[model samples]
Target: MSLDSVAENILNHLWMISWQICILAIVVWGLCKVFSRSSASFRYWLWCIILLRLCLPGDFFQADREGYYIPNSLPTVWETPVTIEDALPENYTGSSSPIVNEPYISLHLSFPGVIVLLWGLCALFLGSIVILRAVYAYAQIKIYPRIEDPAILNLLEECQKSLGIKKHIEVLLSPKESDGPFLTGILFPKIILPQHVIHSWKEEELAPIVLHELAHLKRRDLVVNWLQILLQIVYFFHPVVWYINRKIYTERELICDDLAVFYLGGKRKRYTKTMLRVLQESNDVFSAFGAVGLAEKHHFLKTRIIRILDSKYLGYKKMKKLTLFILTLFAVCSIGVFGQQQTTATKAEGEVVVTYSIFTVQDGKEKSLNPEIFFLSGVDVKKQQKFAPGEYTLLISQAGYHHILKKISIPDGVKKFHIQEQIQPLRREIKKTSKDGVDIDVVIDGDFPAGERIDPEIVALNGKDVRDNVFQPGTYRLKISQPGYATIEEAVTIPKDAKTFVISRTLSTNVRKVITQISYDVQDNKRPQITMEKIGTKEKILINSDTKIKPDSYLLHIYQQHYFPIVSKVHVWPDDRPYVMQFQLVSKPVRIRLDVRYDDKKNLPQQLVTLSDLEGKAVQVVHDNHRIKPGKYMLNIQHPDYTFGREKYIQIHPGDQFLILEKMAKKASSPSGKEYTKLFFK
Candidate 1:
C-alpha cells in the first residue's frame, strides 16, 4: 500500500471502537423501531444500511458524519518522554526523581471490544430474524381473524388517542389459542386476542383487558422490550449488566402500568381485577415470543395490582421550568463523573513544552537510569504555585560505574525531548596466571568507547572482525582482528596462582593451521536436596526443610509453579553438611504465638490466638481448648467470612509456630451487608 493509504487505514482502525459502535447500533435500531411504523420497514432497513456503510471500505468517511451515532469514543492515553525527577511527588524525600517519561499507550481494542462486536452482530442478526418472523406472523394472522367487534375496535382507537400515541395496532384472533388473553406486538406490533378468550370474557371485562395491553402498546413498550433483547445479545458476557437490564425492564413495565392506571382513573380497580382474572385463566396464553407475557411481566403486573389496590393513589405532578433546570444540573453533574480526566505535569518552553528522560544501554538491554521518570505541564513542575521555565536535569549511573550527567536544555520551542547516554566500557585487565601447571596472559577489549559505536555484526558475532583472546580456563571468549593488518592467533591458559606468558604469533598472509585449547578446573557437582517435615496431626501439619545449594539463591517451590512463591533465605554453616537448617509453619494450631517486634531496640507483644478454618468456623478443640501441648496436635479452624486471614491452619509441635496471615484484599463481601463490606478482619 502507498504510505498515505497505510496511514489512512491505520487512522481509521484507531478511530473504530467496536463497543461504542455496538451501543450506537443498538440505540439506532431500538429508537427507530419504537418511533417508526412497521409499514416503514424501509426506514429500519435504511438504519442498518447506514451502519454497514460506515464499516465498509470507503473514502472520506468521517467518523463524526453520523453525529454522536457510531462515533467511536475513546479514553486518551498519554505519550511523552519525561525525566526521572519529574515523576516524584513534590514532597518526596528520596534522592532520585520519580518521573517516568515512557509513553503510555492505552489499548482500546480489549476483550470487551471483541465481545461488544460479537454482541452487536448477534443483536442485529437476532433482531432482524425476530422482526421478520413477527412481521410474517402478523401478515398471516391478518388473513385469518380480523378485528370484528366494533366496540373493541373503538376502545382500541380511544385508548391510542388517550395515550397520545399514533400507531397502527393489528388486532387478531387465532384458532391456535389454548386459554386466556395476551398482547403480542413487540416487533410486529399486534394484539393477538385468542378466539377462546374473547368468547369467555364479558363486555366490561374485555375493555380493561384490552386497555392493559393497549397501555403497553401506546408506550412503545414493545420496542423497549426488543431493545432489551438486543442489549442482552451484546452484553451476554456480563451477567451483572444482564441483571441490571432485567431490573430496568421490570421498572420500565411498572412505570407504564402506573401511567395506564392514572389515565383509566376509577376504572383502575376493575382494570386490576380483570388483570388478575386474565392472569389466572389465561396462563396458557403466555407466549415466550410476545411482549406482554414475559416472566417478569406477570410478576410486575401482580406487584402493580397490589400497589394500586393497597395504597392511596397519588397522581404524578409535572415539574416546573425551575425544577427542570435544577434537575438537569444534577444530571449533568452525575454524568460528569464519567468525564473525569487525569492531570499530568509537563514542561512548557514557549508555545511548545518539552519533557524528557535518559536511558542506559548494557549488553543490548536498555534500562532507564533516570530515577524521576514523569513530567507534567502547567501544574506543579516544582510545586511552587508559580509557573517556572520548564528546564530539568537528569543523571544516569549504574553500580561500579561513573555517572553520565545530562543538561536537559529544553529548546525554546521544543515540546518533548528524549536524551540517551551510551554507556562507556569499564575495561578490566585479565592478568596471565600459571597454577596447577597452566600459564597464559590475554588482554580482552571492546566496550563501545566514548563517542564510538560498535557494529552489531561484531557484537552479535555474526560476521566481520571479532576480538580474539588466547584459550583460557575462564568463562569468556575473544576474537582479534585489526584493519589493514594480518590476523594473529594464539592460545593461552591461566592457572590459579602461577604467572605465565602468552607470546602472540603474528599471522603471515599465507600462514594457516593454529591449535587452540581451553583448560580450567571443574569443581565437584552436588545436587540440591529438599526435606519436608510434618509437625501436626493428620489434618494439621507444619512443614520445614533446609538445603545447601550451589547457587546462593534459588526458587523454592512448595506445590509447583502455579501458586505464589515463598522465597527462602539460604544459610550456610561451617560444620553442617552444607544443608538448609529449619523454617516454621503452623498447621491447624489452637493457639499461635504472633512474633511481633517493634524495632531493633524494642520488643512487642507476642499474642496467642486460636486458628479458624476455611469456612470461618473455629476448629473444634477435641482434647484441650485452653492450651495446645508441646507435642504435635491436630487442630481444625474454619472461618467462613474470614477465609483469607490466618483463621484456618494446622499446627506443628517441637518447632516454632508460624501463622500464615491471610490478606483481607482476597476476600469477597456479601451483598446483604453494606454495599461493599471489608474483605478482611484486622
Candidate 2:
C-alpha cells in the first residue's frame, strides 16, 4: 500500500483506540459513582469481575508476527524475533476460529465520527439536565411561597443547629395535595412538606421524622444527590447505569434511614415503625425529614426494611481489610490503564521525538493561552515534548481576522523560543449624520484602511456618540465642536458601505453641545427618483433608490416609514402621460405613483413616464365608522404576474383590462378535463 494509505490506516487505528479509551473511561466513572459508597468488599468483587472480562485466560496483550521482517514507514532500527505467544493477534481467538474482541466499541463499521457525535450527545444530555434543574427551581419559586410555615420553620432551625449546617433552610407545603414525600434541595435548601402528614402527626412523632431529615442535611445528601444526578447524565446511554442509578438513589434513602435509626439509638424499632407510617402518610410533599408513600419508591423502602432488620454487621478489622483492598485495586487498575500510556513513552533513544510550542501575543504583550487551544494543530500534547529544538511552522487564526503564519528553525541544543506578532486594532469612522428633531440618522462603514476589520467610533452630528455598536438607519442631529473647528454641525444619513464620508460644516467657536440640521450629501449627483402621492387622502411616499429591481418589470414595492409596505403590479398600459401603476393595498390600502425607467439606449415605449415630467395622482381612502367609502380613485400597481405556464395579469383595481385566451387553453390541454385542470394548475 502507498504511504498515504498506510498513514491513513494508522490514524484510523489510533482513532479507534482513543474512542475505546474514552468509552472505558466513561464506564469507569459510572462504576466509581455506583460503588463508591458500597462496601469495600463489594467494590473488590466488582473490580475482579471487570478485570476478568478484560483479561480472559487466552486473550493476547501483544501483537504477533512470527516470520515477517518487513520494514515500516515509521522508523524502526531493529527487527526482533517473535515467539508463538508474541505472534498472537490483538483480538481474542477460539480453538477452531478467530474472533475480534470489541467489547467497548463495535468494529463492523469504521465510523470515527460516531465517537465524537456520541460524546457530544452525552455532554448535551448532561447540559440539558443542568438547565432543566435551574428552570425547575425557577418555576417552583415562581409558584410557591418564599417562606415556610412558622411551625416547620422552627423545626428546621432546630434541625439546622443539630446538624451544624451553616446555610439557612426554607420549607414549603405542597399545594398539589399528593401522597408520598420527595426531598429536593441544593443551594438555599428547602424542604417541601405535605400538609396531610404534618397535620396528622403528633408533636412527639415529628421528632424522629425531623431527626431523620436532619441526618440527611448533616451529611449533605442534597449535594450527593446532585452528584448522582450528574453521573446519571454521563451514563445516559447506558441502560445498566440507569438501573444502577435507580438502585443507588434507593440505597441513599436506606443509608439515611439507618443513620436516622442510629441517631434514635434505643428507640430504633419505634422510629422504624414511625418511618414506615411516615412513608404511608407521605401524601404531603415529603420534606427532607419526611418520606412520601409513593408507589414507585416503595420498592426501595422494602430493600431498606430488609437491610435494617437484618443482623449482619462486619467487625472493624474485616471492614478495614476490605476497604484497603478495594482502594488498592482501584488505584492499580486506573494507573495501569490510563497512567501506563504516559510511562510507555520512556523507551530507548532510537525513536524520533516531536515537540510543539505555541507563542501567543496580544497588543504587543505576551499572553498565556490555554494549551487546549493549540490542539487544532495536530500534536499529542501529553506524549510529545512541549518545547524542543526543531523546525516547526505555526499558524494562528481567530474569528473575523486574517491568519498569521510563522516559520522558525531551532538549533539542536535550544529548548524553547518565544515569538511575537503585533495585531492592529480596528478603526471605525462616522461617515454622516442627519437629524430631524427627535429622530437621528447615522451612517457607518465597517471597511477601513487599518489592519483591523471593525469601526472604532462614529460621532453623531449634534448628539454625542450614543454608543459604539451599530445603530438603526434614520435621521439624527449633527453637532461637532472639535478643537480646530469653530462649530461642526451637519445632518447626515449613514450609507451602508464604501467611504466614511460626512457633510458637516464647521462653526465659528468650539462648543460641546449644539443643535443643527445636517445634510449627508457627501457627493453631488443626479439620479432618477420615484415618488407616490395619495389623491384625496394626502399621503406621500418616497421610494428608496438602492432597491434591487428587475428589468422590463412593472412591479415596484413601496414601503412606508414605520408602516406595512405596499406591493404594486402593473395592470394596464394606457397611452397617457401619467403612466400610472395601479395596486390594491390589503390593509389600509394606499395609492402610489411610480416613474418607470427603461434603458435609455433601447427603444422606448410609445408613451412612457420620465424623471423630468413625473407627476403622481393622489390616493384617498375615506373611512366612515370602520367602513371604507367606495369612490372612483386612481391607484398604481407595478409589475405583471405570470400565473399560467405563460404570462398572465390579474386586475389591480375596478377599471382594469383583461385578455381573452379561448383557443390558447384548448391547444395546451388534453381531451380530458382532469388533464386540462392539471395543466392549468401546473
* Best candidate according to lDDT: 1
The list of candidate 2 runs beyond 4 A from truth reads: 1-110, 118-126, 146-154, 282-296, 313-337, 341-404, 407-682
For candidate 2, lDDT tens digit of each residue in 145-228?
333346666766766665576676555555555534444565555555556656676655665666666666765666655555
CA lDDT scores, all candidates in order: 0.41, 0.39
Cα shift from native, residue 296, model 2 (Å): 5.8
**Candidate 1 weakest lDDT stretch, 10 residues:** 67-76
Error of 1 at 68 (Å): 23
Question: For every model shown, what is its TM-score relative to the native structure?
Answer: 0.34, 0.38
The alpha-carbon lDDT assigned to residue 363 of candidate 1 equals: 77
Candidate 2 CA-lDDT value: 0.39
For candidate 1, write residues 142-204 as lDDT tens digits: 444455577778877887787776777767776665523456655556776767666677777
